[model samples]
Target: MTNFKPGEVTTTHIHSDILNRNITLSVYLPEDYSDLYKSKVVFCFDGRDFLRFGQIHRVYERLRREKAVERVIIVGFHYESVEKRRIEFHPQGEKASQTVQAVAREIMPWIDQTFPTYKVGNARVLLGDSLAGSIALLTTLSYPRVMSQVGLLSPHYDHVVESLFQRCQFKDDLTIWHVIGKEEKDFKLPTSGERADFLTPNRTLNRLISATSATYFYEELDGGHNWKTWKKELPALLKYFLSNQ
Candidate 1:
């Protein structure tokens, strides 16, 4: 077992001209990070929630200290409101594509210049939960040259499953770590009170991607669609993706 200690987290602002708002980012760097070394990075959506609920900094520190995973810088993108998250994280929302572009075009380049990053797409990860996971998938598909890997924790795949499958049929050198709870079969959407069955479509997506040439991992665990499950699985996912790199 690893002793989970908190890492150094700093706050910074990245200007997104497309959204016309300065998005706040919480950057977590390993204790040993320095200008002499370049590290991998994970860009996380729903930033504030992840920091508070996910306890990702502690997980990262434990993994890094134990050598269970490679050193990484986790960047948490903070959202102003639930409505704002819906617009930016939803697959078909008006600002959805623009949000992806902002991360790829604006945020990434800035991170590279500001920090000692690997500066390669394969060394970076796009991570998010629920609808944000949907956006992360879309962004990875759209900008594979910028972000080649994605961590989808209970992605809301109802609306985007078919289209994503169609895209996955083609050979894209992408790596994905996807997990959904068995109990997440039905849940009420936070934005709309409509009930959504996430499990079935997520299973469909797993099968589709498994058939494809891309590298993928799918886990259907016994839990619900909440941060508790995600937080519990975070260390394992980080170790899987960031380990021995």
Candidate 2:
């Protein structure tokens, strides 16, 4: 088991000409990031909490030092407020479309121009938790050429977006790593102020993905919808998908 500690997080601002908004980006790089080595780039949503509660930077550093995962850059986009988080992370929200466009058109191009990144789609990854997980999947499906791999930690599914599952057609190139807690069936949603059945929709999603030929992995743990469970599983997902490939 890895005992991970928090590492220093650096911040930068990028102006998205498409949305006419400037987004703050928090980044973590491996210790030897200055060397002439190309590294995979990971974009994470719901970032501040992930760094605070998930300890993802430390996990990354430890994994790299132990040679358990590949060298990589972790870029996090923090939600300004809870309301903004729900608004932007919602797959049907207008902000979600803008966020996806910013990722595909502006943010990725900036990373490619500024960092020593493996620019191929297969080398890029999108990661998110809960509703942000839904954002990650929607974004990857929207721009499969830019992000081919996704890590979804308990993605929220609503009745409005069932068509996405029926429309999924990226089995040929996209890969997915997903995990949901068995206890998420009666999870309370803050945004909707209603008890949601996350597990059922996630199971439906699992079945849908299984029907496709995409490389996929799914795990149902005896836990709840929280960071503790995700933190525990993060290292393995990183090693399996992003290491040595």
| lDDT for residue 84 in candidate 2, whole number 0-100 | 81
Clashes of 2: 0
lDDT of 2 by residue, 1-245 (tens): 21212245777788888767778788876676764888888889887777788988888888888777887888888887778877788887768878888889999888888778889889998999998899888888888777989999999776545576556566578889999999988977766678878888899889878888878999998888898788998898788677764
TM-scores, all models, native as reference:
0.92, 0.92
lDDT of 2 at 67: 78
Please identify model 2 stretches exceeding 4 Å from their true place: 1-7, 159-161, 190-193
Q: What lDDT does each candidate get?
A: 0.83, 0.82
Model 1 misplacement above 4 A: 1-6, 159-161, 168-170, 190-193
lDDT of candidate 1 at residue 236, scale 0 to 100 = 81
Error of 1 at 33 (Å): 1.2
